[model samples]
Target: MVNFRKYISGITVLASGFFLAQSTVSTVLYTPAYENQKSTLNLPSPITSMVEKAILSPKELVDINVNTMMSDPVLKNATWGFVVYDPKTKKVISSYNENTPLVPASTTKLLTTETALSLLGENYRWMTQLEYSGSIDENGVLNGNLYIVGSGDPSLGTNKAGAWSYKEIVSDFVSGISREGIKKVNGDIIIQTALFKGNISRLPENVVWLENNNYYLPAGTTQEINPANEKLIVKKGNSFSAEKKYFYVSPYMNQMVYADKYDGDGILTTKLPDAPAYLANSFKTTLVKSGVSVTGKVTPRMTDGTPESRKMISAYKSPTLADIVYYTNQHSDNSLAEALLKTVGFQKLGDQTSESGRSVVTEHLKDISFDLNGLSYVDGSGLSRSNLVTPISQVKYLTSLMNEKYYKTYLTSLPIGGQSGTLKRMFLGTGNGQIFAKTGTLSRVKTLAGYMKTNSGKTLVFSLLVNNYSGSVDMVKKRMEKILEPALDL
Candidate 1:
């Protein structure tokens, strides 16, 4: 017989060692599995789905979200052109019908502004010079015509913020003339508008006119006058006054004409005729009021070329191009947008017609290697329904500017979602501050294009163009917000 106590001790030690090894294996495997199971059980379906989405790549997430948005029954009859791109990676994240051209509305301003920023630069300033072709005599008399030389400065006499008001501009001109000690002018006040050569009042072939009462007329209709019953009323100012008034007129009329009783209800919104002539008259009136006598009448000369012998008294510099661009994007100012287009044309192609501007912009797009296969660029402002553009092309154009020196200037000029500009009242949700974009709207079209900052600190360029959508535009906008809001957290 062996010693029973020694045998028991050896068995006990073996059992203890086996138990320890089992514990180590359980901690290494079973504990984590149990914890993971418990955590997964505690998460709801929505939370689990969110977690799954969080792990997906940006492209994957964008694709899923956009696919879902496009599949909605409400959008069954709508036409869409959308694209999201990553400039840093030079990759397209998601796209749906992006190559199809659609009416871009005010988003066309983006093209105009981008071209202006690229060619003219941010510091560019338009100059409106106060010049005289004749000499000033010792008797404080000017022997020549006082010319208001316009460089197609759109904001020349406007009262936009950061710009001189009409009153202030007139005052400055008067002061400039008084400083020269010219008490009397022997010649007429001539308005030189030869800077823009083509039809100054030209409209796109597909331009749509919207009356003040929200009536949409046929394309290419400049006015909505009842020719059989109403007569055109013409108003002429007799004296120089600091107050400037805007009058609506038909495209054919060069002078300010009122419709019927001039209740301010007419087609072709914000259409002001003979702006240069109006400015010239304003100068004449102000000069006379400031004790400078003019012997000749105010004349508007639309022909080209200024006299080489003309001397510049003072040049009124406009706010920087960046400032003008900021205002243009913020307000979606059609006049300002058109001015920028013509300006780029004048500076780049030496021609200020709308056609020349379109050419310059198209060439710029080509220089940047942007495919223009489906582009039908008609006007700088989206006032023309004929201005067609593909969403992909817009996104590509926007992405190309990311590496540019003026990128910051261009980006900041856009309206910030839920904060300022046209988007001030929109995107109050997750998109607030995350979106800096331009908003475009027309009868049946709604578009948005710009930069979006994702939750992961990535910047994306995107364009969403919708045409011929059924239902209210606000509903479409809400759907658009829903689609964009998800990308914010991606």
Candidate 2:
């Protein structure tokens, strides 16, 4: 949770630091009222100080430069600057165009995920029930159709043990009938996936495919992907797996096979693929079974519906919201985020449709007083540049989350600074593990906003927004990420 007091303390630090540099730091631009306040407060970082302090409230986040550091030589060639805020005094540290609204990209997930967690709570789970719309005789034969209802649970079959709800659903049905002294169904197996209503063939064309594929599978199913494959796919010669940690599906696995010996939970000894999409198009890959190999085509389960309805036989629980939150933060799992968003909205709107979830969230943000003028949040994944938000709005909403009715549990869902979750390995080995923040990226936009430790050992709230750069988008964002190393290094 963000501290409200830090905001005020930052102002105090900036007020006194302004005059320390006095005549030498006179080049900084200032607002009329803000300048008056600076003079009245008569405070500034002096040249003799060991640390160069800069704070960007709203106006400077959009235009921070390397010059803010007064030391980085590379910043002269850099695209945008930074917003440095002193924690002890809540004031504008040094800033450049902090007020501009830039494209937020995945950073927008921070908004959507936080909103969902705050309003919905972390204990919330998805419900995928096994229902039958057919008549079952005492002999154990189902005369009609077995309806497979979808509760839009993304975590279904995503157990740490590895399985899917569709498979789980069938497994449950088999067990229920076996428990009932029955062996098989006399009628057809009818699956009713009438859960979400929308187009199913081609997904709505968008920039966030990697992010939104979870919740709304093309609004309709076309390609059948392994439910949990979006994350890590451990295969022979795949690069996604490290010594102990397995990363997301990288681009190098389309043409590799695994040795039978790799599955014992040791390590990926083969070379990793350089790219992640190598496996996306290979719908006809073979998997090894019991040290042997088997090939199969990807199949989509039937979701057609019939008039008959039957009671649920067997079902399984999806992953808890706690794990989902961790995924959302660590990998910036947009798909999971979207799935959770729609599930909550579906609960309120009577269905798991994306449109309904979008509506519910938008309304809720409004209820909490989020600024909607520049924010065009469409999907929860932030895959769309169509979605927008200002730094001030981000901080304001974050403050609200801290005050939520279930703040303690909700806070745990968020990743810890350098300690765990997404921030892990970020500030690692830098002794900056105390810093906790979320990283969001997209072309032309990047953001690092959350909590950070300040010079005085007091907690500080920080939001860094970098937009409108002219370099390779990824490289440009890398520069944005590097800003935090120094900001939190103190």
Candidate 3:
């Protein structure tokens, strides 16, 4: 999405009041070029009258700083776009190449998270129901299959030590089923996952690099893993295709890790090909320990054709949508963001694919009057390189959110500079929670977007996106800070 426009002859300023497609010709560093000169880097209109008036405003200072920083030699090859808008006045204070679409990276989560907040209310929760299709006899032995229908709750059993962990959820299920007076089950435990439609326990196609990734788990009796096994490598293979263990392990990572014991709780994950079967097995094992018996194996199905006589045994409810959004944006959780997108697609478009979800997002943006002319919303998590959005479009999107009822909730969920989430290490000792934003980074891209309160006590929505910069990340960051530090105090 980077606007790779390069000029070699004359300087021209676009309608956005900022320079773009400047000359790449070799010249002295920071040398100003005029329209009548040989290069395309246009010098701005001189402030002859302003100096004659002998008056200076913060906006003028910002303009000066932005122009100075952007004219550096290092940015000669960079494709950049930025916009600073006053939400209250609905006016652009300053902008440069704002309409140029660029890769947003994880900043795409803003669209996903915001769409989720607007579509799915704050109180919405994903529910997993437990039910049975068969009946129990007088000897406390049952002949029916136990069923678990998932709603694609991404946080299900994520925190191993939390109350809603896998072990805890399984314990709750076992106790509830045991209270039904059924001591044994003669049939297999059925896992119903029709709510979500896609590959389970595996990375999405766009994120194939995540394959064979190992997640560490704590060693404890409460946890399902053994103390000696500290790592769970998520891989894609079909060695146990006949059985339920369709997930493969990384032979290399397995051999490298030799844990004699573990000290903390493990990470609960569903990186298997069949997550329902994994859950069913974990549930079955815990149920047996809790004085219940199951003689059948665990299996997964995409249907819930139980007869009308089927009864609900118990259900687990997830945290509210607001809390989920908090974690999703704060941690930049790619999986949760994708899940939200799919959920949006499933609700609005009756499909769960990323394409469908992005369509839903586009529709929502249309409803808000966002200019989507050249923008592309491929995946919600922004892990894909296909996402493209202009800084002007992003600023407009942020400005429109002020009208939403959950605007405060959405703002609170973003990372506060130097304080929370991904921004904890950013804006240190400077912005220090004054900036609420989302960061996007890739090999040659760096972006920051959100709201920042200026020293004059006015809130401004801004987006700064730069791509193809030939410099170290820290160097670019320092340059970005040079521009932002003055703006933050504007």
Candidate 4:
């Protein structure tokens, strides 16, 4: 009461200080210029449009891009097909030319692999038996031919995808022969190739034979091998070509079927005249390296006709059929794929020819209720020009895979984007591991089929096939990537 004026002045100063501190804190917290003004807190139109596009529905995006893809000048005379489906809902989200039949190329491996996985359980193994028809004496000498009867095993000496190695093969066979009390062979080693009935022709693109006695590369690839070291130095070339081709070989390498020739894009490949003989030679060399002495030559024959009294000495079992299929599909391995196809025919139709394999595949597709109005299968590896199928049929087959008991194994066999297999260089920097697919390429045809994971956690299956394109194939791939880009956004 004595100093009312002074008391009022002190209270006003305290209130002003408090208000200033509160204003400073608000300014520090609100960074955007628009945030300072309550009425303009909304984003600008450009930023808002980007946000909307990022969240666009899968169907909406497909619809928008399909039209653009169809109108591109690169596809002037091309027959193209595209389909996207939802497995959970069993519905087609988008499609364009989905019913048109197109050459599938290596994508044919998909059908071959799927059929094999369904018929042959995951743990099924291919067997190569080694036995002798005659007896060994007390001095450890055998008087009969050692026979190798294969059930079309493509993994005998291969390490690319199989679990068995050359060392294991040598050890196992040596042990088996030792267990039979045989220290020396007095007869020739014969590789019987008629067990499967049909003969397989060598693919037109194989060029290199590895030191381990396995053919490691297929057609459509080129590598520069160092002549001095017999090692690979460069591995770059077209996967498919019509006008130009090139391949390389190391001069110091062993186990080669023939000498290297040609240096340009016109390299020609010769058929494997005698596969059984080649394998026999490789095995003979391995036996010699393991301190086994033989006084006989390695030979190939059509039939063993071994008497029923022949004793089974040893057998080499391949890895599980599932693992083999995984490697086949992942690398687009033509040899393995064709072998599996023939195996399927042998199992189902009692015939091992490509035509018979095609029949088996046709029957399988029908059993699965796939619409095969224009589908065709001429060979298991799709190296033949006779294979054809529609995008719609492929989509249906892929969707049906989800309901199968071995669906997980089947899916894992496909090439993961930017992660593994043939798709390692594809979809880089944009969906990378999010896409798992199988790629197919011919001179003028390109195709991609597989499963994709969306940004929203939804899974989509798609098949995009393009054939008879007029421009460069690389250009077509770029356009296809653009068309599929929206799926990543979804």
Better of 3 and 4 by lDDT: 4
TM-score of each: 0.77, 0.61, 0.75, 0.74
Candidate 1, 383-466: lDDT as tens digits? 777889898889888988888999999999999999998888789866889899999887778889999998889999999998
Q: Give the Å error, residue 399, model 3.
A: 0.7
Candidate models: Cα lDDT each: 0.71, 0.49, 0.68, 0.69
Model 4 C-alpha lDDT per residue in residues 1-490, reported as the tens digit of each score = 0223443344345445555655343322213353335432122133333433554454565565666555566664689999888888888878888888888878888999999988888888888788787778888888878887777776666674766765677578778877887777888887765644445454345433221111234433223432112222333463323332223332322212222223334343422323344456666777777666778887767664644356788888888899998999887877678788888888887777766777888899889998888788877776555689999889888988888999899899999887898778777766778888888877677889989988888888999999888665556666677667777755
Candidate 4 clashing pairs, residues 3+ apart or interchain:
205-219, 245-265
Per-residue lDDT of candidate 2, residues 255-374 (tens digit): 211111123333323222211111111211211211211122222242534355467766656666666776776667655667766776777787666778788888888888887766
User: Which structure is stronger by lDDT: 1 or 4?
Assistant: 1
Q: Which model, 1 or 3, shows the larger TM-score?
A: 1
* Poorest lDDT segment (10 consecutive residues) of candidate 1: 211-220
- The per-candidate count of clashes, in order, stands at 0, 54, 2, 2
Off by over 4 Å in 1: 1-61, 200-249, 252-272, 303-308
The CA lDDT at 310 in model 3 is 69
Model 2 spans with C-alpha error above 4 angstroms: 1-96, 133-138, 159-169, 199-309, 416-421, 429-431, 453-457, 470-490
Error of 4 at 301 (Å): 4.4
Q: Candidate 4: worst 10 consecutive residues by lDDT? A: 250-259
